[model samples]
Target: MSKLACAAEAGMLPGMFKRVVVFWALLVGAGWSAGLPLSPKEVVVVYNANQPDSKKLAEVYRDARNIPQDHLIGLELSAEQDISYDEYQKTLVAPLRKTFDDRAWWKRSKNPEGLIIPVQNEIRVVVLMRGVPLRIKPSPLPEGVKVDPKDPIGGRTESAVDSELAIFGIDGLPVQGALKNQYFQSKKSIREANLPFLMLTARIDAASESTCERMIQDAVEAEKTGLWGRAYIDIANKFPQGDNWLEAIAKKNLEIGIPTVVDRFNDTLPLNYPMTDASIYYGWYDWNVSGPFLNGKFYFKKGAVAIHLHSFSAEQLRNPSKNWSAGLLERGAAVTVGNVYEPYLHLTHWFDVLHDRLLDGNSWVEACWMAMPVTSWQGVVLGDPLYRPFLHLNGDGKMLAEDKDYLLLRSAAMRWGNDPEEFNKQLGMAAERLKSGTVSEALGLDLLAAGKDTQAAVWFRNAKEHFEKAEDKLRQDLHLIAIDRKAGRKAAAVQEIREAQARYGPMPEAKALAGWLDILEPPAPPKALPK
Candidate 1:
């Protein structure tokens, strides 16, 4: 029967028969069709065309894989709209979904076996800014209290005590246990008497360096009420003894169950060499060796989807040479050529290639690390408007390089971070870049890491998109077959399982997702007993 006739007939069937018959017809028809075989898995990718480097990088992936021109989808975001988070999501994500949904190839078919996988691609840009200053209120002082500068205890100590008393007034002793409860009262009295001006000035000009000490003591006393137990403990541990400041702080905080420094406290320390561990410190060290220290930790916490080249030795940076960067890539990283007097030239070359591949709507991931200099010169340069997103690393105090090449790399990374739309775009790019039929297979590994069957199913669909060739198709099929057996998607997840087996052969993930789907989907009704 003709496909349209079969479709019409299947549509006429009542209830579940229509769905079952349609699916079977499509499967049988595909076996007889003369067209190129479909892949079991699918993939999608997203990118910003405004970034020349990103565009270039996509191209390189495409050329390397020999993807067809028509298969790629390039989505460009305007520079003005790209800077705003809301604008990027609305302008980019919405159009992307529409483009895929509108494709004729994705429409439901009469053939029972045919499946249409839904995927999306998008790109985003990020802009960075400097830290804003905190606002602090003035202190207050008591009346009829005069400072004696010549006293051993110091004029500042007496002034501060007097201020505390004035702020608290006669109600101070009674409210001692409920410091927080009394705080507003004290503040109210200080404000009413306008005692802040004199007390603040005296505190600032104090001869004795015991203000911090006194503050700690008062805080400790306040904790007796248990109203500020945790806060009091934390405040007391800020100052640590011993020559090694980092170790001391670490020890002190550890005792109080606070593993990291407070945001406000971190601001007080010098930007460079802030932490005690010099070798592992990100801000103070050179990028090549020191970069990994920060990268590893950042990836552990924030889950970096892409990686870049930093300051690895010359031997580790090149291909067809003594050093190999693939080890890092294998561990979910990407490298850029480093140490060239003109790093941008090399970076631009790679970016061009990557952009082309992404444009093809294939499945692929790119990584790059910039070797930012730890100098004020670099900071000043990065502060310019052009390098907004690449201003500084999250933990590092130094600014990133402001050059367009580096900025492009930084922009891509930030765009991908925690953004679902951007991730879908990259998946599309990965789909088109499967050489040796390995892209889909490789993606299965990442899907497993995701720990969500639905998400893995989406990724599998992306893998199948570019797997039209027999070898690529078969490779993807096997992966799906495996996924089926493990995840038990025998029914609901049958689409993914069957696709994987059809394209790649067998897949553990396909089996797993299928098993899970079966468990989730209700069982079919038993045959009628009456006969």
Candidate 2:
């Protein structure tokens, strides 16, 4: 059947199906879940056509993500950190607009002449490459134009490149200043977001090119094991709003089911605190790395995500040896977000929104973009835009110890496959411990990862047979689907999903997995539109 026909059969409009797919891709971040993997079809990579390094970086990302060649858009722009408003419009904006139109990505409406006029909503995100201008210089006031008294930045001027891209669909030059993010605090998944004026924007940026590449790789790897570390939030003696925001985020962290450590009364995470195994860390009001940082004594887990709020926190994302952003990345964080310039406390990332959104299952890029009040200002999200942190919530409750043990199987599987000498030694150990479905499932994943599909399938079937509860059975079945997909058995994966759904009948996991598969693996392509 055609893709549109499949949408119709699924009881959704074609546009709604696309939106649902986009929404699912953005929200489904974590391990062995029902949603689609982030696809190249949903991405558009923008590069400075004039810069060799920018082209090189864009190509690397595109190749890594399998982004379609047509999805790549380039513009000739100056190699400067900032540009005037006119220059922004003439160079970046105009070219971007033209590219979207040519690609049939920009929304269109029928005019009085019965012609299509560009509107909005073609793409979910625009990834600005390394060479693009990072900020826009404010235009001089013409003939005594008065600024809004309520404006925070002494007359709402200048804009960040990624932020301005959020408002790219606005008609004429946007002089009304920074656009407000409607999605803020809504905590809606991207599929549920009511975005009309702006498309989400992220950039593959850092102080250096190698750092940018590593950031992307880390995001992908982190998504594999899922976000399995700790959340450390440190707040000093607070300002009313700042304190409120910090407290709310701390509350949100607990609410979202992450193992969170909230240090509210202290100036920082106490120096003596054992701050190891951090997956997500947020601390603020420090001018530089503080006591909580522990002078490199702590070890951040692979794909760790951390952020520290300070004026120049992002001054050098490339320098791992430094005190701020780079230091966090160097110390092994998969992602870190902060401002490029001195964004006063209020203007920086809203802790509440950022935390809540991540818990709600938005990717790092989407969460950061949605939480930021002013995109054209200073806040910059640095990481893989596709990184989804909370994809493995097993029915609202945290993953049980058994479930965590299943996660450890990834390492065991690696050892089993890589160390042939140890495999024989481990075989005896597995015979004793592989009596349960959990261990069997881990073995299944290990074998699957090692390209042993037939053996993996046998282990998965064994897990299903040994399941103690309907819930356990359903969880293993869902996991089997992920394994099948990875093992190049998508057809078998669908069969497993359908069979589980039929047996389980409307369980949340079953329904979500079914819905995600329906949207992700559409029946077939409709005509020649982009995949």
Candidate 3:
């Protein structure tokens, strides 16, 4: 059995409780309103007053997300991405908190001694616009402060600015090795909806201000059009922990019926294999994944979520057209999760959890925060917090006529949409292979390549329903969900998951489908008000 099997068997997995109470609690709008993603109005934008471009970038983002002008807070700070801990406390954390307090952004109360208790914070997300520093080098502990035994590195440490925001108020507290995320997987811990907002921050920074501006625009478009495309997962067989996490991610994608390609090798996918229409990507352990996709000219679908796991992968994002996170942004990915400093192996975000939660319909911020084990550490979430990729997969999973996936697929495969001869050739080829059940799938592929995706989707389904064996048919059904996603027919794909569950009985994949279906379901009706 795999580690996941053991965990599930032991019932130690997060949110595994089958009880009604647990389910209902989790079902509550855990940080989201019904039919809405995280609102831009709830976000505060931070920029470095020291950099003119930073202010300009903030303005562009505000326009894109409709963030209020008052939400933009410019602080006098260094242009560099790395800073000392003292500098962070003095310049970024302390000053920002003071501004929030003075502006009455949220309510706080004080005791007789007059120490304020942060009762309610309205700002759920802090959007670090371009030019803000990315990390803080660990400062030495104060005299008489004992070292945390958890510091396997013997007191040396560093922190990501986004991570430290989880504990933005605890600036003067004694330094520990790292702060474990208390709400890491707590279904009830999403205090954003009813209580004070804490943790959860995203940054918009890249090689250039224009790139940052473009990211904001792309995210808005993706949310409007839907996040429908392929997923590419690459794993470097290095440490067991990292490898296991990546493998789990691929496995979960397969279980959730996402169209996916996984490459487990020392190297990444070669440049020649087309990676067009990719909406999701995760790869790791190396400083960077070398591939054609890295070039600024390569662009994924508008709402693509891409991340390369590496120490210091997010160390800088000022060059909108180059290096790590910024490079991905320049190349058109909307979301990038990375580290700003050496987080060591155990402190990084778990890719498996990230995948599962996103599929569960959690917005990017909620999903990222839930998966991250520690805050006040090295991880940084870079994207729009309210972007929910799976929101497109709701209801009957039927593809909407307006879904961008249809257009994206048409653009990539069907020159037939442009050329009549290509359309005729596909029609001719599809007819020839329809006679052989085993070869019928090839016909669908040919049609899909010619951009006759609706016809191709029908053929693929027929191959599964009529020609494929039980096990093979089940797999095909899952793959068809990917096709459904690409064609913007998520309602049909969701129905496929239901049919598959009935056919397979209580299998692992079936159970995963049930869980995902819950995520796709609308929030439970609000409890009746008190009589």
Candidate 4:
């Protein structure tokens, strides 16, 4: 039986008593019965009930897993109470404790052997901020500072209202005060146990000018309390100004020692114009500004480890070509090149690929690997099939593949060839010999021709992998470490460097990689919170 089926059966089995009785009977009748291997437990998703989006978010978990409705649980919290921060803490502790207890039980039931597996591995909590503003601030408005009356910015002071502020935090001094207290208390409880939590802070009044300040303040508070490891800011559009705002908050969080995250691309595209041109959409200028942020050096320097680059459509890549769409692989490569940041690209194109067969309905995994060629920044000239027409008989009357030295010459001719037949012939020969060592060498040269450092790293990796399989350890070791270092695997690359040093004595490149890794590792976790 499959592992999932076994898990489902185990879950469907009766209580402990019944299971024990069956085990006893099996033991008596069959003399010995092997214990079943445990199934990988399903993830438990929790969201606040009060938020309208709460159900939708919870549904995402269920729909993703296709689990029975009963498997999902929703916890609803009352947003009506107006109390001091301390009182709010007292009010939430009891219910939160109950939820924790229930979660523990659910986790325990999944493990028939009673092994103490981490609940986080099986439980994911999506804390929806209901009736909370996207941003928070100290009340008692400054003179002449009126909360917009038409907006009724504070109308939901007593009951939950359909205001954007209510989307993230509560209204009025008391409700807002209560939420702050609850937030810290809950954070303390979760962090004390070293639990992971995801906070999606959204506001109804997302476009309002004051929202940015509140987001910044809240981030500062969260960092101070160690409440969340990751923070997601969801806004209406993709404004460059919005990115600037996030950069500012990321800066502030770093100063106070907080790991702040900005969830770009969660909403619609922010730009007013259509992003259908590769030059316009994946321009290097925007990346030049954002790249430093990824390297932990831009506006505010914090030892931030990673950032997420999400793209909902391949259309976001904006390739005019009909044969190949500019997908995450292309965009990611471009972003990495332009900005020198290696952020994970969340490709939403797989959904379209699966449903529409736009890209042969290849699973996301296959798509990712196919895109790896692009991600490695190898230009389309080498990989695209359209260039196959250029391989014609030379004056000396020799097929291009007959001589290794001629590969680059042939590729160059194909790249610059005017006639479709000549391009296709050359491309065909190159494509046919893709796995040949000569072809690999030719690809490396092509990358050099393109002056793509990142693509050189990829070629190095491919060459190393092939050479290693043929027992060429020295060449394999050299190229693998080089590629790893170039691709942000600094620590892994360092390990390879150390191995090389031990194996071959002090090599210059190995020593350099070691030094670079030493500089790249983040400082040890802070001993005490920043003053």
Candidate 5:
């Protein structure tokens, strides 16, 4: 069983018993909202004043995004990743509040809950540089208090600094577990809403300073030329709740003409799986980074956006070999998000919503905060928050030939969303003419999903012949093998499987074939005819 399924079966999914109560308390809003757009002017960049590199990164990002010069603020902070509560308030919170007050960046007034909060904020977004602390360690609840039943996570206090800072400007609310994100799933923007403003904070941080700088550059380049590549989604079939999110994402990508690989296996994409041209990736439930990422030879295409859904995926950002956020950054993912501590599943970012918003042209930070159930929790947004992967979706300027097929397919999909038959016909023509494995494989997957296995086989075969990468070709071969088995060509399927095993022995993909072989040719059944 998958991790999520096991947890659910074991009755260990936190807040499951009273999820309705928690959802009503935190997410009492309408259905998913449209993207809340942001401009560079509304952003404030923060960095550790004592660290020159931190300040330099802030400047580099600000200049790259054209943010206002005066919007930058620097404070002396601890060099550690985890900060104590008192240290957090004394060094980071208090100083930032003072800066906002002195600079007139916001107006503070008595909130109805009877605490001072930003009532009219000129700045609604914040960007933290690499050297700033990552998270705040948990503190004991004031004596004689028990866990809140209505909202189980409300009693826990450890959180990412970016998460906590989001609501620190809202009011002097006690730094507890999770608070209601009034804007979550709501169509209203902070300026247009009635509640006190909640600042949206993202960090341009990674394992190295150079990586941070490159992330900024990549975001800019991707926006101008557009991010065109396949999406690799690892679906941990743990439970329907998480599975639905990934399935929806794959469906959406298919409709939008982006080639996507949706792995239905309980685990992540196998090690060293042919994962070329990966511009987008979303997976979950691994304790730490694993699979192809561990191979050290697999690098995401330039300006790639990736995320893994482990509880402590972002626990540390300084070690390239450690957590999800750091490992992804080290391996060329330009944008990613994860939890700095144990963020319960319900409170974490809804990656499906994040993908939808990004496709709708929302900036990375806005998409993340817009999808999160609540801020002041444990999630942290890393990389350039202003990056929008689909901002130039339909445009074709001086982009490289490598991005052409993706642009062509995307433009066609956008133009033909209401008509599927016509869309497939056009895509098939493109695939045949271009002889692109990515395009051919995408069509095959779509066809397979539509239950046209015979048609899918043709495309899969074409993809196998055209693909250059060993893994890509093998992936197509697997698709063909499955189709052959479905068509009752068991002998042929078994022959091809053994041949592939011989061709790629000891590889993860070969291991998958071995699983298929076991199923097709099981151990000799006992001679039970006597019964």
Candidate 6:
């Protein structure tokens, strides 16, 4: 029987069946868009026709994702990283507009304000390939124009090329500053929200062609097994806003049953902090990629999604070792988002919102735009836009012990969510049976948050035993010592640190212990020997 018949047989209401069936048909062959409103048919791939790698990358993505043949739009463009604004309009935007009109990818209509807008936009996403220009250089202002002191962002006319492309449908927008994203914090999908002025944009780009290909493959692989492993959240604790963003993220992770490690240190995570099994990482305020990631031996888990917040985090896209985004990509992160220029903290991607959206099964691009307060400014989503990292939340109970533990804990939390006592009891029993360090650490963090430090310490200890890495155990040591320090056992905390410092030896993980030691025991100042 036809799918329409199936829908009818499934008891779809008379008025909604056609709409639902048509939507289902659009999703029938779209691989990465199962639950997302977007389909490959809605995506238009833009590439640099002048560059062999540009067009090649577009084809690679198209074949991999089974995008439609006519969706690929290659244009002659500059080989430089930064393009003039005029060139961006003439060579890129104008040509794209022409293509959309000629091909009837969308229908134009007048809004209530008589503004021309796409009433039925079939093309909702634009995928810019690697060789396309990364940023648009700010053009000179007119001779008579004067800057306003109160408008901080008005002076900045530069924007990420991808970000600029996202709003190509809009008319008469100012060149300076950013426009508020219509989809920011939106509870509905782009289609459902009828967001016609905006087109979700993403770049499948990296320092090298091989890395880009790997990124595409990794995103696909991640959706299969699920984005599994512990989350590493480095709280810069700079301001309440930034700190709260991270704190809420930690709370959400705990609620979801993902094992999370949160570093509350003001300074970015120190060098070689032994961050293992990191599938999701969010940290901030570091300019260049440093700290644990600096270790040559360290790399995140396959399909890991990491983002290190910085103003110019994506200043240059082709240098893997220079900034946070590319560096993480080269070091095995599948997806990351960043700003190409200086965007104020609040205007940047709301990391917590992105986390929630992804967990709620939104695609990467949708979640990214939903996370940002503004666009046509400087944010870029790097990786397959359709990657749904937490799609595994809809899984059967049969997975690896580590992966399965996440499922089991989430189930327990859902079943007894209203009863904290029952929730903890189920978690404790699962930790014992599964022998999962991730589950134990999750429970420990939850208990610690509830002010049950003693119980938290027990689980921390249990987690330490299950974990094989020395740094993992040392993290548990820090947890235990923190509990001791709270109980006015500073001396015991210091003693444990001293022993751990010696036991762990000169390994990079020992650096974290030494830091705690200094906090607990300040070394004596040089005696006033001269005095």
Candidate 1, residue 123: Cα displacement in angstroms equals: 16
Show the lowest summed lDDT stretch of 10 residues, model 1. Answer: 375-384
For each candidate, how many residue pairs have backbone atoms clashing (under 3 Å)? 107, 3, 14, 29, 0, 0
TM-score of each: 0.19, 0.63, 0.67, 0.24, 0.85, 0.87
Model 2 TM-score (2 dp): 0.63
Off by over 4 Å in 6: 1-36, 109-116, 143-146, 482-491, 515-531
Residues 6-45, model 6: lDDT tens digits: 4345343354445544544444344333244578898999
Q: Which scores greater on lDDT, model 2 or model 5? A: 5
Return model 1's CA RMSD, one decimal.
30.8
Candidate 2 residues 1-531, lDDT tens each?
432333334333344346533433443433333333445676788888888888888998888788888888878889887788788889987888788777777676665665444445657767888778876666775657687787667565666667777767665544635556766655554445646556677777776788778877877766654677556677776577777877776555433334444555434543424454477788776666655354445557766778887777765445554547766766667677776666678777787787666765667777887678765666777667878766553222233332343222323333344564454234324423445555555455445544576776677677677656665566556555656665567788778767776898854334545553664377775689677
lDDT of 4 by residue, 411-503 (tens): 234243445344334433443344433334334434433345566456555554444232223333544554565467777877875676577
Candidate 3 per-residue lDDT over residues 1-531, each given as its tens digit: 322332234332143213312322343324333233566767889999988888998888888778889999999999677888788888987888898889887776663555554567767778887788888877777678676686574465577878887668542444546777765764432553443636478888677766767777877776654577667777878789888888787666543334455655465544323354477888875555456454334577788889888886777776543447766777788888888778787788888788777776677888888788887788889877777766544211233332322322322222333454554344334334333233344345545544677776676676565553453354445446656645667687678768777887843334434544454454689899999
**Per-residue lDDT tens digits of candidate 1, residues 1-531?**
432343244232233234434544444454421112112112222335555543443344334334344434456655331122234335443554455456532322222334322222111111111110001112222455555656422222111111221121111122111111111112122123232211110011011113212222322222221110010001112322211323333333223222122112211111111121110111111233322222222211111112222222122222212221222222222111222111222221122222222212111211111112110000010001111111122111122121111112222233443564453344334334322122333234334434444555555555556444443343344345435544654553456544444543343222333343344454788888995
- Provide the overall lDDT of each model, using Cα atoms, as 2-decimal numbers: 0.26, 0.63, 0.64, 0.29, 0.78, 0.81
- Give per-residue lDDT, candidate 6, residue 476: 86
TM-score of 5: 0.85
- Which order, best to worst by TM-score? 6, 5, 3, 2, 4, 1
| Candidate 5 residue 503 C-alpha distance from true site, Å | 3.3
Which of candidates 1 and 3 is the stronger one according to TM-score? 3
Residue pairs with backbone atoms closer than 3 Å in model 2 (clashes): 29-391, 30-391, 107-119
